[model samples]
Target: MTKRSAGTTASPRPGRRRLVIGAAVLAAVLLLFWQRDRLSPRRAPSEDDLLAASPAQSAGSAPGRDQAGPKPRWVGSKNAGTGEDAEASARQIAEKRLERARHTLEGYVQATRYPPGARPLSEKPDLQKPHSVAKNTLPLARPDHKLTDARVTLEQDRLYLVGDEAARLVASCTTSDGPARCEVLRAEARVPETMPQASTMPPARVAFADEGAGGSTIAALFAPAKEGFGGYHGPIAINLDLRIEGEEGAAQFNVVYTPAPPARLTGDVREVIENGSLCLYLRLAVDKPGRYVVVGRVDDAEGDGFAYLEHNDPLGAGAQEAKMCIFGKLVLDERAKSPFVLRDVEAYLLKEDTYPDRELVPGRDGPFHTTKAYPESVFSDAEWQSEERDRHIKEFTKDVKEAEGELEALP
Candidate 1:
């Protein structure tokens, strides 16, 4: 009986040992899995994994799924094949540049016509106080010939009249002629000028605005100096023969000849005749020869008023006494409620035989220079004052260094 019991115990021991080994293997496998989970980098689920984890549903009604298995996630990136956005951005930038250029040109024209008080300190000339009109020194003369050979040039969509003969013809037309007569001649001239012509002729003046923008027609006439016109040899009368370019229009405007205070629009001074051009003639009776200003509301036929214009004629020493024609461009807009608003004004000097050959007259003292000085009161804040002071000091130091270098280079 004892031998039989011992045999049974040995068989049970082998079975028990096998069971213990199996348990140990299972624990080791679990530990390896835990270590891998803690140490290895986690990866986003693949498309297949996502599909397997998603709840089972009808193929047609799956969540976040279209006809395809899954909807594509959109990342913020531009497609290589599509360039429409880039092209549109570039076009907008180009348009802005063109607009800035046009405005700058208009401003220059207006600056030339600014009055003494309105002008920058550097450009302002000496003038006498307000005084009564003296005897006229020059007799008014009109353009005798018709502008038959004038031609038009379209640049940047703007129309400019070009032709020496045409300029001479228009310059000859006397402002004394009633506005109706002047308008007739001007309209007649435009008819032929608008037609195609040779491109060799020099540009006389800008005649019309770009398409869809407003247009203007201007003719400046000079009268021969009389015995006492001003104290010097300048023109006795300056006739601004102007008409709206596009359609027939009219507006009430006042012409303020500086030294003489601003005056109301009187029939004798401003008359709107049937033809549409406003014939503005200024008879000079000043005691000296210097710069003068003419300010007023001279509207085009479309009710667009003249903003500003600059005219500089460098007459030959000998011909300064003769009648001289000055051509200039001006800015006009319907947005300007007051003709007195001065912005982007400039004056370009025109050269002609009647005038001397000289450098173009400087319109303003310096680029970005203005008559108004910056006030120190603006720098009341310590931070702002400090920053500005530092900037000015830096500029001054740089200027001094440059001067020293220039001096060293000089003999």
Candidate 2:
């Protein structure tokens, strides 16, 4: 009967039970302390940081898989070259955008000059009837700087603009091994205060082939007007950038410049007559004083996937009409038009005086997917075409209404 009470601890000789429990708790705390140094941090990442760290995440690839990084909402995938590489997707969205931009620029180029006759060139067999240069108060020629079939040097994994024509202008590029990585080449043309007094007169009668000598994409940047040339001379500068992408090999481009008032513009009419181009007369007022750069560019894109077209032209008499084939070839359509026409062009200014090195977009040679520069001023498309004015007005009204609705909804 003197055996320890049923509920009492046999070892509790005065508070021994409480001391045993305390020692057990101490052992547990020591165990936890030994492992506390192995934890990680937790916080949300900024969007840019997330993108900078994992460029391919949005492309549906596991992070770190894509070198072009994430595709920006503004860009679209397109193919703008020929040969085996033509089948490859352009890492830069500029490839696709350039196509759209060319349509617009084609309009300008056409407008700048006249096709050989009033009728379409394809319908006219006497393509050389009254041979003449396309008209442009402000004319542009393939610069002395020329480029060749863009050669992707497999050995170096870089691209070179070579060939007899490539020797004209100075340019350079750097390449990489990745598919999206493009060896971007850049060339600069300093716009003279006046058209350089050329030893060679303008081509007597300029002719543009559906397939021209220049490769898929090309750009021309005009500098501030220099001294000498009258009427055509002024503070105006144009930086035209263009390219063509997609399965269509045909390149189209256009640009419209309204002469500042006090500076009148006139055209030879015959110049544009040969090209079936359009012309516009603009009266500009120099409310602002500055030099402007008006730019134009083009790209001959070969469509891919669903964009590929196939057909052949019909031969005469007993000859069978060739099935029109557009496989990776550009086809000219009447519908393509210009994308942008900037006025009051000024020197490019940024938060940083120097141009920042942008990340090369996937399938591109540089971070910027497109080479087209933005308008330096708050100008509108309406300034280019009266048709665009109405749309611009509607857009403004919609914006005002949306802002009002948002204001009303706010607490």
Per-prediction TM-score: 0.15, 0.17
Summed over model 2, clashes come to 72
lDDT of each: 0.26, 0.24
lDDT tens string, model 1, 63-164?
221223442221222331245654543344334433433433333323333222222222222211111122221222224433222222111110111111
Q: Write the per-residue lDDT of candidate 2 for residues 1-411, one digit (tens) a residue.
A: 567777777555668878988999999998886665333212123323433342112211111213334434422223223533422322222334333234333333333222111122233333222211232221121243444232221111111111110111111111132112121222222223343433222211112112222342222222111221222311122222222221111121221111222111121111111112222112222222232211111222221111111111211322121111111111123222232121211111011232121111111121111112222222121112233433433443453454345434433
